[model samples]
Target: MSNTQGPVLVIGATGRQGFATATSLLEKGWPVRAFVRDPAAPKARELRSAGAELAVGDLDDEDSLRPAMEGVHGIFLMLTMMEGVHITAKGIADEERRGKTVAELAAKAGVAHLVYTSLQGVHQDSGVEYYDAKEHIEDHIRALGLPATILRPVLFMDNFATYNRPTRDGDNLVLALAVLPHLPMPLIAIQDIGRFAALAFERPAEFLGRDLVIAGDLLTPPQIAEILARTAGLTPRSVQVPVEQISAFDEQVGKMFAFFNSRPTPPIDITALRTTLPDLMTLEDWLRATDWQA
Candidate 1:
């Protein structure tokens, strides 16, 4: 079969990173199989319109995943954590179960490569449910001896446009979050991640069995505020709330901020990733390019 004839099975293909990866693969002349919950959903239809073959399957069902993996050349795996929802014990268990199921099935199906998207700075005793669950899944994938490349992404630039974007207070752009304004945080565009995943599959000799922490830019909260302010024609103000206040809202998210705040500087060398994936966006560049109303 030609490299373009692949059956690259992209789990979570309806969502952000998965969609980006699937789109990138298509752009690179590779056939993509998108495994999604509801093929009738609009986003799934969008994938189909974009030329990805749809495979209806639930992440929680290993049996469903089996058929989806048939004749697959590669796999893009991610756990579907409910963003902005309160993390419950059951949610954490479900994430682990679903993530581990995908990993095991990929191995059983003899997938050539499995790309797992996980969080950066995962610690075993991090006391954060989501991050630790990813760590557990990573350990399991490693234990299975599957040829895997783990992509650890930082804070997404998309969050600035959607979930955590700046709010306008009078003439000022107010960014209210849990961490200090000066804490350097790594960030990336989902498209960049997709590009890297596609390149990894194409160059398996260089990427297989690697754990690459990928980011496009590193900027602090206040720096981000200034960029948005510059782009949107407003004064910038940052409200770094107490961890407790954030915890009252979201314990998991609050702990994540505490982790970010405690670490003065982001440890990831984004430059290290530029060799393979270049033209990363800065905060100013991203804000200028985005349409807030969209």
Candidate 2:
């Protein structure tokens, strides 16, 4: 376990953040053991092709995770709440259970370090069910006295390409969200989360027991729209849709936005984070790197 060359197990290795982390670890020449439910799945196969050893298992089942933890030095744990994307009570409970089970199993295996990806403001009692669920797992990790690092990432920049993508409105591409036009929202590229996780594993002494809240940039909705328009060659405008409207459409997301509006801004020290990961991508940088054409 003390051996740095030993594999670092990546839970949920097929998902966005997990895939990024597993690839980062492999690129850094660290042996990676990807914990996947289906080793033959596309992303899992992709990891294997890139030199990762697959450990097939489900997070809900503790016995299934044991073999993955065996002989591993560290674990990059991220239980994405895709199951509860709509935010149901059962989804929240299932996520919390999955996360805690991983922490408990990691501790029992005597892994050297555990890096958990959580959301920002989970400690502020935001009453956001998903964030609260993550906080519960964080508490469990601490209570177990596991040597761990917690990375609290802010909003994902990738949201723009999916659910938050701009909609065409006559001559303009309209971007709408529950946040005010002037509120500075912290944003991060998912790849940077992977880079930061790799950094933590590489420098265990500096990161162990630390709770790092990370973001690449902070911009208002209007500012974000301007960047998108300028980079993607589209006429973009941002409108502040009422939180109530958002809640009417998606109750869970509405609660998150309501919490976002309640706070002046999220807690993320980009300046300090830069000292650690100087190559963190800004919105413009991210836009340039991807195929974000309208």
Candidate 3:
């Protein structure tokens, strides 16, 4: 490791955000240690191939994190909700506990800086159990007395490629939510979240104690449909998916849309963010870059 680039531990390294963050740091010439549940997993093997040191650990056991945290330059803490999209009360509790444990462990380990990837623009409760858990963890991290940067990312464009696929084959992708196509919800590429995380660690003085709301471009469902049409070469329709099918996940997402609909838009200044991370991805940029499969 270079003198400036010490070991940085990345929590949830096997997952989307964590893996991207770790990869970003590695590309920046930082020695990266990936903290994952099973170091032998395929993604873990890939992380190792990409020049990240593997540290086996789980959020449920903070002691497992101690070795990963020991004498680290910084820590990228991306804690999972511990289960599916439809979060429960127990799931919320687990997330909060796990995040707090990471913060406490990082503080105890005497880590230089800690960056937490959190959600943005959520009101009290926000009708989403997971968002509430993130809010709690954010508060806990702030109170930890550790030098920390809280990067609050809006909706991830990666969701479109992964869980929120617009069309299956040639079928019109219908999305059911409380808000209409015109209602703007801040969105970013999950890869951009990683890019921002790396930059935050690199420049602690500017980012420390700051809550950055990150967004690449503001687009609604209909607008997103256009992107899908352009990419997929098929006209996509925007109808709300059935709420009854997904239950709380749908209800919570509906509330999120409603919250976005009623409130002033979040200040995720793209122009300002571009000064540091000039390559921060826009929706079009993401669409062009992604190899969208049917």
TM-scores of the candidates in the order shown? 0.94, 0.96, 0.90
Candidate 2 residue pairs in backbone clash? none
lDDT (tens digit, per residue) of candidate 1 on 50-127 = 889999978767778899999999999877567446776678788898889888888999998999999887753566
lDDT of 3 by residue, 120-181 (tens): 86444466667888998888887888899999888888888767766544555443334456
lDDT of 2 by residue, 1-294 (tens): 123658999997999899999998899989999999998899999999999999998887777889889999999988766553466777888889988888888888998899999988888989888889999999999999999999999889999998788787676778887897878999999999999999999988889999999899999999998888777667879999999898886777889999988876655678989999989999988887786865
Candidate 2, after superposition: displacement of residue 242 in Å? 1.8
Give residue 225's error in model 1 in angstroms. 0.5
| Order of quality (TM-score) | 2, 1, 3
Which candidate gets the maximum lDDT versus the true structure? 2
Model 2 weakest 10-residue run by lDDT? 80-89
Candidate 1: C-alpha RMSD after superposition = 2.0
